[model samples]
Target: MSTIIEQNQSNIITDNGLFPSNEVMLDLKNLKKVYPTPKGDYVVLEDLNLQIRKEEFVTIIGHSGCGKTTMLSMIAGLNPISGGRISVLGKQIKGPGPDRGVIFQAPSLMPWMTALQNVLLGVNQVFPHATKAQRNDIAKYYLQKVGLEDAFNKRASDLSQGMQQRVGIARAFAIKPKVLLLDEPFGMLDSLTRGELQDILIEIWNKEKITAVMITHDVDEAIFLADRVVMMTSGPKAKIGDILDIEFERPRTRKSVLEHDDYYKYRKHLIDFLEH
Candidate 1:
């Protein structure tokens, strides 16, 4: 159902007309990041390049300080680039915009606001021209999709950590962003909760088909959720070390993926990279 086209240092995964089209949605060229300190300039990333195609899910993995989060922040326009450019659909990113929705490790919701109200915050910004009823519907729709139908009216402070994160997921998608940026969105939860959230995320992504980029350290999680697993070398000048194409069929379940012949092969390869 998908084809892997190997590029210079990256792999492009394309479906056979399942998505709208096989086009580059996110492009990073000669990307660099630096922090000027009194001692000297500290470089975080240099000459990092990657292209994420439409409807593709790419996960980045690396050792602790490999600039994975830095790169992701640049794409989200939350951080400034020291050099090069990152573009979405041919347009260069200047700053944070509605087209890209970011979900960080923390839910970062306002304690005073209810779950539905938190979702409405972004919906209101993105759909200002739409009627209030339409915006409310959009917010409610995503909340239900994330299995927060009963918690819609609950204040964020009153909800469990997992429930708060569900609200975060709902808020990010409610904006209908063209690209979703996830920085260990489930890192704070228990293994069971994390797995449940992963399934929920993939289910939503299957239907939305939004281009996604995630930063994760979990090897199995990276393989299960990604079309391509990007491995980054150790920092303080991290660059992509290698890219692995995951050829698993879509509508993937944990059991099906784990049972696949190549699953452990992929796992071993990732483990080898991380250990070495």
Candidate 2:
């Protein structure tokens, strides 16, 4: 991983050597978000700007309450922005739509629904124009893709936490969203389960070719999954403190990414700001 300082170096390994702001897909310009608090205005973001290109996995690493999740909520149109603008494919995003899919920290599945039915909810809502057969096929395909084939008939309440998250991933993918937003999707799982799910998510991302932005506190997970690791500063109002380019080859394995020359350097860099 290449840190903020390393980005200044001309020879940094970028995709076809493209610069940061040149090939943009989703762009945020001078975004500022403030929340109403008893203590007055609590600003989360100030003059924050970012540009994400097509089909890139961008992972954001920050301390708690650094406003990383706030930024994602704004981008997903789940929350209103206090100022500035966010554009998706050059169009203003004013509200939540099927084009942006979010996998939040918790599974948030309906207790009364089965795993298969929960996934079908997204299919029903997003692909309302399609036939019943098509919706069923899509939902089934996504569930199987996430390794939940056997659990398809199980109720959400009956599944384990890991199993529930798998269902959540399948459901999010069922919509065929243009962008995928993940908020600590693997944080709740055990080490072995976490690795397995990470692999599953990587496979899904490769097959779908969807643009993904994830907010994670896990340094290892950020480096393992993302094309670039974006670090935020400590906040009342946070800005981009660092941007790290991951130089590991495609289809990155845990051992390979860890063995890379700059891996420890990157880890050390991120550890510094974790104090906040």
Candidate number of the best TM-score: 1
Which pairs clash in the backbone of model 2? none
Candidate 1 per-residue lDDT, tens place, 175-249, comes to 989899999999899999999999999999888988999999899899999999999999998998989999999
TM per candidate comes to: 0.93, 0.89
True-structure lDDT of candidate 1: 0.90
**Which segments of candidate 1 are over 4 A away from where they belong?**
1-22
- RMSD of candidates 1 onward, in order: 4.3, 4.9
Tens-digit lDDT track for model 2 on 1-276?
443445565453333344444345677878999999998999999998777877889999988899999999899999999998988776779898889999988888896999989998989999889999898899999999999888888999999888899998998889988888999988888989989999999888888878899999899999889988999997888988888878677777778888888899888877776764
Report clash pairs, candidate 1. Answer: none
Instruction: Superpose all Cα atoms of candidate 2 onto the true structure and report the RMSD in Å to 1 decimal.
Output: 4.9
Give the poorly placed runs of model 2, Cα more than 4 Å off. Answer: 1-22
